[model samples]
Target: MRIIEDPRSYALVMVILASFLTPFVASSINVALPSLGSELGMGPFMLSWVPTVYLLAVAVLLIPMGRLADIYGRKKIFQFGIILFTVSSVFAGFSISPEMLLFFRVIQGIGGAMIFSNVSAIIFSVFPPVDRGYALGWSATGTYFGLFFGPTLGGFLTQYFGWRSIFYFNVPLGVLCAYATGRIGFEWREAEGEKFDLRGVFLMAISLVFVLVGFSSILSIYGFSLFVVGMFLLYFFYRYECGCDSPLFDFDLFKNRTFTWNGFTTFISYFAGYPVVFLLSLYLQYFHGLDPWMTGIILSIQAFLIALASPVAGKFSDNKSPRIIAAVGLFIIILAMVIFSFSGFLYWIILGLVFMGVGFAFFSIPNSKLVMGAVEKRFLGVASATLVTFRVLGQLIGMALIVLLVDVYLVGGSVAVGPFRALMTVSFILFILLLLVGLVLTLKAR
Candidate 1:
């Protein structure tokens, strides 16, 4: 009598939908920042917080939520996250001030962490490793599909219906995702009897908050002190978790070199990659005189290619060695950064997008597969969350760098060629060095 008979199909479909919606929320805001700034009374520096707060919230919660999913049921937490994300979107849409909007954005980030931390774990629980690559690839493809449309649709909504419409627009789609999640009809609780580490969670949260806030304010002596304190607290958390029988984190997972190296590359890759996407919207619109619609289309190309390539890459990795595929992907990303660093021409930018798109697609699946496969099935939730945590942290730090450079150099929201070029040059140097490090790490990963 059920329309969806197979549990595995339900799992895949639901995860893909969740994956699409969450990233759409994240990526859509980039195109709407100018509109948000204008209407919300925010300056360039303050605009950075629009995305940063959401990411910060997710980064801090992912590991804890992952552990909770293992101890409780992944399904229950996932469903709650989607409803929370959906409700927060509505609240964000109706916000009367920047403060109100940020509070809701934090709520949205918490929901996103809950939803994302469980997705790969769910898939891993439902499918064997041989089949997981294909499902994960398709689900990641869905995420790229969201990334592809996020800017384009966000720009359209902001241009015609106003920026608030971007938030309001998630309502129907979010409701649909939540409904689908319920119908998944299966629960995964691998560590059902394990005790939740409340102290570890508190320590982790404060450590991350200090580290991120201090990273943003790093030009100050106070910020430097906070950063040092954060690092010490992180060490304390590490020491504590290693000794706990029912730790919130799985410290033993990193004993596998493949997992460690793959996680490092994930961190480095996103750290170097996303700032370009974040800043390019401003450049295309303010400096080059493109409208939001045109700018979205320009930005959407890379994700489109990423969507196309991910499934194929996933399948390819299943049949052969992923080492060359991953290395090639990293090299292409470095190459794309080279093109971006030197030129702002439309032709060159398109070329760079082409290379970067394929590169990202090729690199991601292999890295994900390695990290996910290295751990035992019982620790899948933690492994998945750790992979996502690296990604979110990398993205958070990358965006923070943009805010810091923009504040130090540029005067306001509008983009200027001189300042933009200066940021690009610095970003490229850092990007390329990290890419090389990631390459070395990937080659040595198992």
Candidate 2:
């Protein structure tokens, strides 16, 4: 095959593949969770760790990996990430124990961090401001496609070949991404020669791990203690970064109002939105008695709509104020969740998914465009890492919250109609509060 030499196409392909792989792996695993857990003999608590561990690894490592990309090279780091992720997927499929699967998942998360931290940075490096939203929109479509297909395809694989096939499915796609990475000619390292703050990375990692682990532990005394320690360490991380000459994360970047507020709102959107697939999968399979394939088909409605809407949202933001676009999107999300809270019929559930699909597309593409468009060239990697970090952190929180709710209402992951409906209702209220804050902040930002 002839090498594609144009820089814009290079960036677009890279972002799409990178964006596709991370979410594909995540949602695919979600659809396979029941089958995978059964084979591994994992209970509800241990099973939750499968996805939690992956997100945690990504959350802790994203900013550090982004800093490394800035210091070393984005293409180099990105290529290595794809290779590592592909290899790990193979190992994860072969794993005979839950422990082994979780370990490989952690490795996969590390690779996920490396792939995503540079995606936006590379796009900005190649695309000019006027065209950046277009690139981001297309990239968002790739992400939504991953979301769109992950469940349906994963269900197909799991049903026929067993859950292990879900992991194996990525082998070819990962190889394709790796091959594409090699062909991209230009390298981005805008922060070369900047000293990497090793201690800061360590401190941040400790703080984040403790806090997340504790929070996921959920209302336990030991968990609360861990949370306290994590909070202190996080505060210490803030103080340390403030004084460092070459901090891994710069405190000053928050001074950019557009960057700051967009980050906050994006975080809120993902927090409330990320768990819908996971929760609904369980609801349909366990409660409604639908098979994985049928559940996947139902779930695809939301992701498919996102794929349809993201590019349009991106293009529209180029013409309108991104703030208004994002706010409208969040408002739609609130509406979707409200429908979910009351959903007993399939129609209501589908309606809710449709609303969420459009909402997330409109919110995410423009929100990302705003944040990336707001930063300076020197801070590209920082901004990219920060945007992703916030999004992942919110996802982590959502998952943790789900675990808590599951323990309280799920009765060993068994379905009780009243409790299940209550869970949805509670989540709906929480989402409204969260998205409302994000909406106010979005409009408030300059």
Candidate 3:
């Protein structure tokens, strides 16, 4: 198979593969948390940071790194990301303690930021506008597919081998991806005399970190204080961006209704949507006492549905109004959430998972197409980076809300299935809001 006939296509595939690995590492560790906690004597607070720290790093760094890629060269920064991610993975696999593991995970986030910030930009640049939607759809599918397999694969490896194997699993895949990216070529356009906005970068990074950290700690102590500080820092960060000669985020992008609404809708939808995966896994393992392998099977059902539906949804979005498609998808998600709120039965839970997956597929692929379509080629790096930053922020806020809600509504020290039901209620409400956002944006887009 001469897959390399179009060098750019080959390069896109490598980027997709590299990008896929990060999410795999992100979700794969969830199933292993119990085992990791036991081995490392980690408390629930510290265990939570294992994922929080990584996500926080990625969210904060994404925009700054994307701007840097635009200034320097996308290929240069992307290659560096691969090296950093690979090295960090090795460090994670060999960590002697939780602190050491977290340190490496933070480094892993830096690498992930580099890969994710540049990927959609690279795809847009390589493929012509007409074909870009389908190409991006394929790329988006690769990412969701990674999300699908990550937990299940992590659970399988962790159960049969050890939790450390989750980190180690990326070693070979990373090496191959790095090699593929090296041989792949891109036409680099230098920002002739574009100066970097160091101040804007610093403020944004600090602002996002404070916000995410505060939210992550909401389930713990000083939740109100953290929230206050986070809001204050973000206010300053927005002011800082406004004054910068070269801003990290171009507020002008938000002027486009498609960009604005898609970003907002993506944030809300994913914010409420992703926690279901995390919470459900925990429910099955901790509450129902399912083994790691069995939990993997249950999670796989959701992943499989997503895998099946995403490409179809993406194809439809290319021809029709993504706004309508996305709303329909959210409707499915709402249905799934409603069902989840009422059910404690295992079979019903599985059916709900399937619906949730279908909704995600519908929502994600088209939403991505809409965002990318809204931006010009010149701004693709920043646009893609901004999109990812919002998504990560949404995830951070979503997870924190879930944890906080679980703490408040939980009757005993252990979380009951009832709180999980309440969480579903909240998720459904968020989905309805997303549908409204999508509808307004679609109307405006027309």
Q: Each candidate: what lDDT?
A: 0.86, 0.86, 0.78
- Write the number of the candidate with greater lDDT, choosing between 2 and 3: 2
Local error of candidate 1 at residue 244 (angstroms): 2.2
lDDT of 3 by residue, 20-118 (tens): 788788878887999998998999989988987888788889988888887788777887898899889998989889999999999999999999998
Tens digits of lDDT, candidate 1, 84-147 = 9999999999988999999999999999999888888888888776787778788889899988
* lDDT against true structure, model 3: 0.78
* Quality of model 1 by C-alpha lDDT: 0.86
Q: Candidate 3, after superposition: displacement of residue 406 in Å?
A: 2.1
Off-target runs (Cα >4 Å) in candidate 3 are 34-44, 190-192, 218-221, 282-292, 342-345, 414-423
Q: Please give the lDDT score at residue 362 for candidate 2.
A: 87
* Total clashes for model 2: 0
* lDDT, candidate 1, at 285: 77
Residue 66 lDDT in candidate 3 = 83
Q: Which digits, one per residue and each the tens of the lDDT, describe model 2 over residues 200-269? A: 9999999999998888775989999999999999999999999999999988989989889889988888
Model 1 stretches with alpha carbons more than 4 Å out: 1-3, 33-48, 96-98, 279-293, 342-344, 402-423
Provide the RMSD of all predictions against the true structure, rounded to 1 decimal. 2.9, 2.7, 2.8
